[model samples]
Target: MKNISKFIKIIKTLNFIPVLSVFAISSSCSNKINYNSSTDYENNQNFSDIDERDQVLNIIKKADFVKFDSEDINKIYDNFNYYTKGNASPYIKIKKSLQLFEKYWKIDKNSEPWVINILNKYDGPDITIDAINDEIIINKYDKNKTQEVNNYVEMFGDSIIINKKVCNFGYDKKIKTSEYGFKIISYENDILIPYYIFNTLFLSPNYINLYYDGTKYQLFEKIVNFDNKKFKNFFDCAFPGITPFKEIREDSYNSLKFLMNNYYGLNKYYEYTSWESILDKYRDAMLDINPDNYTGAYFNFFNSLNDLHSNIIIPSLFNYRIKYYQQSNKRKTYAKLDNQLKNRRSLILENSDQNTNFFGYLRNNLFISFDEFTQNMNVKGKDFELKNLFLSSILKLKNHKDVNNIIIDLSTNGGGDLSIMLWIAKLLSKDKEISFYNYNDLNESLIKSTLSESKFSTQYLSKDFIQAKNILKSKQVILLVSNNTFSAANLLTSIVKDYDLGLIIGAKTGGGMASIMPTVLADGTSVAISSNNLFLNKNRTQIEDGIEPDIKLPYDDFYDFRKMEQAINNFQKTK
Candidate 1:
């Protein structure tokens, strides 16, 4: 009984999940990439015709190369060790890591050279990062010698200023580091910079020996090799360093356990699974920690949690696991659901005259649908085009005076921007204000928490909203949802239901309400977990378990527009 009590306590305190692993580092840390020594730096003779050779040269010369002395490097190492004490929680460790990165690395100003170098190496667009002037100048190399493009991204304090406007919406001034790189974190969202850029520029020899080396240039070379059809180099780069296998295993296990224990919101709700027992079962098999063994253990652990929002984000591990999933029949449910959603969307497109999959209209009813809230995953900036498209779609629908219905299909949407979702809710609702609450486990204690609510008013100046209101005043609004409708999409569905803005039809939504918190492990592997921000309805009830449909339909009916139309019509007649 005492042992049982101890086991339970362990289970509660150390919320264990399988963490995906990749070759973070191998024993060979000193080996350098053999770049062509003949490559000229002064004249930029190696640069392609498409490259902004002069601009790149000028940027590199202007940007100072920051070098750390031995003492400075030691201090960074000591601080990291002090912050990531064995007793400290993962949240504290992560927070400390961020603070350390910010203190040691003046990334905001000094990051220009590294950014430019990366772009140049990748054969990316001819771009210039002028830190002196505090602007990122992008010029597309057009063969036609078209009018010179002068797109600029500027920096002001911690905010990213673009075109003289502050583009930092969901960003706070705090710098958060991940394995991929670092990001500026806001309470609601984050803008992630590409991986390895930070470490490539800042990591010193001492730091590399004690901590992890990012090996940015080496990784880039591997990517180039892959592009050139040299697959071996790409795969070999996965495990570049000489870090001991045993140490890697231990660090991976401990870090994942710590992260999940403190930050994962669904811990109390999920059935306790003894990760110790699971690990012990795989202990002997995983003694030889190759990619296969490492991946198997971590993959199983992650799979056990059944949490979509939480997972490891190592590049090589992701590549390995994706290949694994492709070959294996495991997790077939997700695959099937993905295929079903694709088929349904394809069917809708086939039936409708919509040029794009984003939105359409049929039989005087305006249908708005998009799979993700983001316009472009690569561009970490405001998407004016997406916003314009959404607004124009509403206006187009409203222009049809005979139309008396608006149908929003979110069955296939995996979710994206929270702000966009709220905006959609505000546009459709009759109420002047829409309110939702969030419960955040700020202390990482999982007990004492903070409850906060956000209230959005229908104050948008878009003329489309006026038209939207007119349409809402007369037309029936219907929301189509399914088990696949997740994250922001699910949240949108919940708002529509709670506010009585529309009649919801289809199936229960896939719930993923918590904002994602990304952090790096001790091994330098990046991972994201479902944060402590548990979303709540108007009554303060948790919406993480998913919102049930007002009128559930057969799964097949979601794909059949005719059936959906018939159902909506019948429901209206009954009303």
Candidate 2:
């Protein structure tokens, strides 16, 4: 089995997923991006007017973005080596190459965006990458043959070097971070195809000199493998030129502050710890480190985040947050909860009515195992009528007289699409009410806009789900959850608990309640922060501790059939 532990499923999501390809950016990195209503971040801004858009546009347009063809890139490499001759050392090349890559790649940190790239051989707009592997499927709703590719990719600290390269690497991750950094291929005539895109825009960006490091020579370059032509740039410096320490420090501080203010839900978990205090601790820690040590200072800042998602990849930086990044190789279980999760499949009851089935599982008691909030293939936004399988399955159970309770297994699930969550919530509600209000960090305009739109993206419609009724006329629900239940899944659990729609039967969910917002550092590095603290209602039903269960059943090796029966029976007595 692949050694992937998801409890610490830290991610780099802009809206929610950050491991995605930077495919939506424009061709040129230097040209300023015009931030419009469409730059999705899970939530949208109510942006007072077009002026707000213009204001953002004016700020970002200062940068000139450009694209370098393969020939241009090859020429630059040739010229640099020719000029340096035998005199240049690898150290010199390293520094010079960085500058050259920065200039030519137009890697303006404030504007680069990462998006899911789908190179479909058939027709249709590509499916966005909200989550990878689990939620992402190729041509999910299409009738085309699987597009062939050399099932090949090289992984770097930040970006994946696919056969369809975005640009030549100065180091490795630089090409992917630049405005011309990501690519996708669309196949029409059966042969493999290639296409590329980059997002070139930013607004109210606090630009900084991120590459300026005082202890420049201390940079560990061994981790990177430079080709022969590129290797000449790494010159052994006879004249050591260290970047000023103050420069890196100032950049780090300014960028950190801007991120804190923009993260809409940064204060939502203040009860857990204050963002200000956390920032202070890290900022203070930076002082204790060697002032010239930008790497250490930057690592410390990254390590101090309350957001696990923030623990994603930073270019040239490996697993500095080892506590969070390291995944367990062994698939063994230790805790009682772990045992329950391990044995969850065996413990579930087989449906009495085999006719009621969903995604292969027999929905006897109307069990829908929503492993992820992924959309079905051929499923379009708000087009629930086409991909409303879960709803139809639940409604199928309603026709049966014996079905009185439902079980939704959200165990081992990481969140996916917001629309999936909303649609499900709408279907489960008996009173035709919204399950919860979602918002983005610091953007009050977005909260108001979300209130107005009542949907996350402009792609959704209230009408699609308006027809959704209580799939269960009056049946109770038993949610099977654990620490794995997170993000949009956590929101669903809370709604179930808040609305008294179900009895949470397992461990408490891992609350990833706030909207995950990705912000770029001055170095063009991006990571996601839990920016919005949303609520189901006025009670501010908590998202952090996750939804509490009515019957807190610890996991057991053998399925606790008696306990389940007792809990269900006990609930029926009360009802």
Candidate 3:
């Protein structure tokens, strides 16, 4: 009875489309059209007839029905049977399963459960395949045969071909079966269409994907292995627009469906009372039938996936990190200049035995508080521009003379814009020119940064963007730093210590250093590309080890101001 009804169902589906009769074409259109010269005849042919045929061909072409040759199709079938014929080992069985999966899925990056389910059957005790309700779980096998997976070449007479390489799998020993019985990768996801995926891929589905993942409707691949010619003819009839007699197989249908579903795997899930109820009540959506709230409902359903890697979204949300950064820059103009200037200054007193000034300020002379540095570029936020504020403060302090021998503390400072650091260095020197290391040309690379008497980094180094080479040659400087001082902060410290520009006294600095441009992905996610590698001073020391201070102060002594004061007093007396 079931077999009888299957034929009836196919007939019913065929009712809407007209099946082309070869006899009818031969009788009516043979005189006017030369089948052999069909391409040329298209121009001379009746435009209306040509358009009709084109539309029919378009529909047929899209339908998954036919393929190029019988031999290619048979090869897949033969391969499956060959592996299944013997009581093959788990590895061999897995290979056969993967062969079928590849044939079905073709080429895609991520894992699709439909294809993965087939592979589960071939796994040893280490893998368990379960379909409870409408959910499919593929987990590690329980068997503890912890032997590494051997190379296919080592195990078999022939090597496994991957990316045109024979037995390249041995390069990474980790991928080879470790002390485990077999190499396995497990994944978990709610079933989309329990009936369809399970039946087509797993060969069984106990329940429909109704209440499983809150999905109201699910799409499934329906694969039919038939005689190549018969399948092609059926495909031509069902979808007349698609060209007939093309290569079509179960694998082709599986591959196309896999791509579409994976590419458009809607994050949305449907809520239902039960799996049985969904199959009985809501299967029509799979057929692409129209509903009342068409567009809105469709989009709402589509957006449910929420996965940026797999799901689609509106234009606004696409490439989100980049857009946010751009938007932030646009709003930078609205930020008041004075507020930015106020934030750059770090007010701290330098207590020296011979110092005349109190509340001695060593401003963020670099980039003169981020304002003068990031001046024209549109960027927003106090946190994002925290370095700018520090620079602004340093600039303010450079001109104030109530301050004497400066103490520029990079102790806990993580690092920021290199331009800002250079500015600060220039201000400390008091000379119009200050020479510092250039990352690009370290062999004998020299940069002269400049500062105005009143402002931090007021001048630029024209030679290598030099502005203040003279002032740095004259000032008495004390540089304080610690392990937390890293990146941009470390870069500045490296210059101060190497050139003897300042007396650096503290613990080793945090060495994290990388110069990279930030790139925002289409989904508004930001990523940094660390392409250029920057090195330390001419000593050839790498930044990864961080900059060690010339004088290593006791950790407690540095933190205790009273201890530091006593130490400074003792030094002054000795002088």
Top candidate by lDDT: 1
User: How do the residues 1-575 of candidate 2 rate in per-residue lDDT, one tens digit apiece?
Assistant: 01111011111221233322221112222222223421211112233332331121111111122223444421212211111111111112222233433422322233112223333221111223211111221112222433221111111111111111111111100111111111121111111100001111111111111111111211111111223222212222211222223333334454555455433354545533234556665665443324334445555565555454343334212111122333212112213344445455533444332211133223346555644565542221223332466546655654675766577777656676655565566556664343233232222211110111222322233332334344464676678777767777777787777767668877777776655544444332334456533433324234566667666666562235456667668866987
Ranking 1 against 2 by lDDT, winner = 1
Write down the lDDT that model 2 would get: 0.37
What's the ranking of the predictions by TM-score, best on top? 1, 2, 3
Clashes of each: 9, 36, 86
lDDT of 1 by residue, 517-569 (tens): 54544444444556544555655566777899877788877656678778877
| Per-residue lDDT of candidate 3, residues 1-575 (tens digit) | 00000000000000100111111101121122233543311223232432231121111111011122334431212211110111111111222233334433222224344333332322111112322222223222213322223111110111211011111111100111111111222222321221122222231111111000011111112111122344322222221122211111121222223222211111011122122232223223322212222222223332332211121111111111121112122123222322221222222222222111112232322211112222122223113343334334444444754433445555645454444554454434433233322222101111122122323222222322122234334444666666656556676677677656776766787554434322111111112222112333434344545687866766555434455445554665776
> Higher-lDDT candidate among 2 and 3?
2
Off by over 4 Å in 3: 1-403, 429-475, 520-525, 554-559, 568-575
TM-score for model 2? 0.49
TM-score for each predicted model, relative to the true structure: 0.57, 0.49, 0.30
